[model samples]
Target: MDFSQLKKEIIEYSKTIGIDKIGFTTASTFDELRNRLIRQQELQYQSGFEEKDIEKRVNPALLMDSPRSIIAIALAYPSKMNERVTSKKGERRGIFSRASWGEDYHLILRDRLKKLEAYIIERVPEAKCKSMVDTGELVDRAVAERAGIGWSGKNCSIITPEFGSYVYLGEMITTIPFEPDQPIEDQCGTCNKCLEACPTGALVQGGQINAQKCIAFLTQTKGFIEEQYREKIGNRVYGCDSCQTACPENKGKNFHFHEEMEPDPEIVKPLLKPMLQISNREFKEKFGPLAGSWRGKKPIQRNAIIALAHFKDETAVDELIEVMNKDSRAVIRGTAAWALGKIGGETAKAVLENARETESDEEVLVEIERGLAFFK
Candidate 1:
């Protein structure tokens, strides 16, 4: 097929597959993208992966063994409901980052991308393509920008004129030598609103974000959070929306989250008392399919305890004590101790003292003493 005919067919096929934005680019556009990945790794933005692991991302060929073109796609994830007010206050509620309110995007986007890949194979037969939805080694946002899907905002999120930054990104690496789109100029001029609005100052002067300091990253992390950073966690149990919420460009835009994406009311706004009382089995059953499930029960339970402490809800002291004293997970105990300190009272003080006596974990012991000092 001629290049002009190929581009037209590709765009039409992508739109038919439910993607709001589609762009194509030569795989070689990643020459500098590799350097940026090294920089991000040095800055500790990538949590699970090491610097060497990210080096592999620079090679599009590594993503699909032999990639000549990148077909980047984006799906808008609008939030129709006022997610902020969906849950009542003081409930040990678990708020799903709006991205995960309904059916998992991985399933939806992967299915759609698979259909598109099948279509390409049928047309070109020799056209080899691999589907990727925020997975694999390709730098999706970088590819998205090269494909003209959108410019990367100061917050490092892809921003399209039609949907802003509230969208899911996916890509297909293929042997098809399609025409590439030039990246649009960045529109984030002199606006530090997203940076200023960060509750924990995760965003820096440039578009750099210290994800280690990001509340979104801290909350979802599996283990005991450092005591100093605990207070900054606020009420966010999963992903944080502060940066997106503060962006002026997103102002007045209508949200339209799919019906299946709506968060489970129980998951959205769970009662603290019940949350503290549930067993691991119950936690797994409730949050298994949700984004929060990846970290397991301890991190979430810890966040709930911290929320109770933040709200100064002393009523949770007894439940927190039970977990601190008896729960097998050291992370949960540490969080309970942290919460007891935040919600100081006689019961909290006594529990703190008792936990300090028997706790062997150095981190949990430190949190225990911090709780004890709060009551003193």
Candidate 2:
């Protein structure tokens, strides 16, 4: 079978299907990435969301039988929103990171991969392929790097030259022996922008990140955010974009290639106060389409409370008092207590004082005490 001709056909077909970039690499074990994963594990810097087994993450052979090559594809997302949310006094908004601006990238990338997989199978009847997006055991960034989709940036994003770091990546491991593309040279040279711009210094150094301290990671946590990082979180309700926004390479690199990736400004940057009171059905109806809502309403609600405090939004005081008094979740009630203190009006202070007497949960009680401390 003419595998070289088949590979060429796949490349041409990819363009017709809206895949922004496609590259191929031999399915050798990723030794460098394996070592880095070990180091991240040793330092306890990894986000618990990753696959725990490091071996499966680095070896394509384990994921699919006799894998001969990996086909990496990228889909560019818009960095700038077409419509703007009107921000006025008493109606402040919180921002979701650009990655979460539209439909969940995982679904979009999976659709692309399925199309590619079907196209390959049609050409070679016996072809076997395994596809994955971010959640899979295989590291998407490592595969994209080796497949020449992009160079690994200092911010730990796969930085594609055409689309900057604002690209969604996925891969398919296949039994076809496609010639590998050369990896791009790292272009971040001496640029400390991403490292310097990280809100929590999550970028330990170039090409390394402490996910525990990353605002993007922290915003997704179901528990109480650490006290030290709460102020730094600012108005980000989902992920943080400081690192990507700071990179020079990404400057003016907005792409509105796919219709599904367009942002609904009101949804992505909704009013913080409304988020606090959104019912489960309402939350699913509104934010359910975006990737940022995957952790459900608790974390986003917690962050929204924190954002109100960051803005010191006096208008949200009444709602916050209600949450502190009546919310079922201790984390939400506790975070509301903290925000009330941070906002600190006579009413906010009075609510905290009242909750101090009635709040039963030990953790919520501690947060109430901390809230009262702000008044002193």
Candidate 3:
């Protein structure tokens, strides 16, 4: 069996299935990634969402029996919305980062991966394969980088020359010993743009990040965001794209190759006040298709309250007050109270003073005081 010919065949078939870019690499254990991850663990930089077992994340042999190669694929997503949402002064909206704009990328990548898997199975019935997207144990960036899909960028994203960093990455570990593709040279040289652009200074240095401080990670948290980051989060409700947007390589690199990845501007950039009032069912029905909705609405709503505060949107003060006074969740009520303070008005001040008297949760009371302190 000529494995090289088979690898060439796989690449051709991948293009037919809407895979924008595909590359192959030997599946030997990722030594460099293991060292980097260990250092990340030492610095406590991990987001807590990653696979806890570091070995499982770096060693392909652990994920599958006798893994010989990894096939890495990148699907480009649009960096710009094709249509524009009307901007009105009194109406405020929060932005979901470009990555979350379209249909959930996990499903898109998984569907492509399933197709690739089936193709391989037909060609080589004995071929064993295991695939994973972002949630998988193996680091997608590491696989893509080694597979020559892209160079690992300073923003911690795999940046393809054709697609820039705006690409969704997934990989398959297989028994076939496909010839490896050469990795692209790291071209980020002397450009400190991504690190400099990070609002939270989450990019501690080039190619290293403290995920705990990243706005993208913060927006996904269920608890109260620290007061310092609340202001830095700006109008981003789902994720942060500042670092990627700042990259010189990414300039003018927007691609809408996959229709499923095109965003509906109204849904991805919906009005902020309505988000504060969204019922769980309504939130699901409206945002269920987008990747940003995976963490559910609480985090998005919390960030929306922060965005209102960031905008000082006087129109939203009343809705914020309702959330502050009536929302069942302490985090929601507390975030609303803080936003009310930030969006300060006589009504907001009066409500905060009254809520201070009635709010039971200690954390909510602390936020209420934080809100009231803004008046002084």
Q: How high is each candidate's TM-score?
A: 0.92, 0.99, 0.99
**Alpha carbon lDDT of each predicted model:** 0.76, 0.94, 0.93
The runs of at least 3 residues in candidate 1 whose Cα sits more than 4 Å from the true structure, single-residue gaps closed, are: 49-52, 82-92
Candidate 2 on 230-343: residue-level lDDT in tens?
A: 999999999999999999999999999999999999999999999988999999999998999999999999999999999999999999999999999999999999999998
Evaluate model 3: give its lDDT.
0.93
lDDT of 2: 0.94
Model 1 worst lDDT window (10 residues): 85-94
Residue 55 of candidate 1: its Cα lDDT?
Answer: 53
Best-to-worst lDDT order: 2, 3, 1
